[model samples]
Target: MKKRLLSRLLLTSLSPFLFINTASAAEQAMIVFDASGSMWARVDGREKIVVAKDALKQVVRQWNPETQLGLMAYGHRR
Candidate 1:
């Protein structure tokens, strides 16, 4: 039992180091927000466009330097 426990602890501790050398995070991210009037349209008693806009602003402000984003909207024309 002692030997098994030691081996289990050893493997558990070393597993993170093994991944430290082999694993890496991705390099890029992207975010987009729709600006259309329909995006602002209320659905299910909630305003989707308003919610989306606020969420998008928060996320974009917190984005990493390696990220890029594009925004587009439609249907507000006269």
Candidate 2:
């Protein structure tokens, strides 16, 4: 129940970015993801990395294919 609610809230907060004006020129988005050690910590008994991955999946599913998307991950390596 909590996970579903959190997912809905996350998607709602990002709705603006998901729906960009197609009338304008091509849009570009850069997603900066954190893969630090802290992300291994648990939230509500689930790992933060798991939560983040789920959210990213949701965002990508709704993303406009016409728009360019880039990903940059940090803190993955020592």
Models 1 onward score TM values of: 0.41, 0.73
Clashes of each: 1, 0
CA error at residue 60 for candidate 1, angstroms = 0.8
CA RMSD of all predictions:
17.3, 3.4
Specify the poorest-scoring 10-residue window by lDDT in model 2.
14-23
Worst 10 residues of 1 by lDDT: 14-23
**Tens-digit lDDT track for model 1 on 1-78?**
643444354445433332222133544433333456666566445576655554455555755655333444444563
Candidate 1 clashes between residue pairs 3 or more apart in a chain or in different chains: 39-49
Query: What shift in Å separates residue 1 of candidate 2 from its native position after superposition?
Result: 2.6
How many steric clashes does model 1 contain?
1
| Residue range 1-78, candidate 2, lDDT tens digits | 988776676567645554444455888776777699998998778887787789889889977897888777899984
TM-score of 2: 0.73
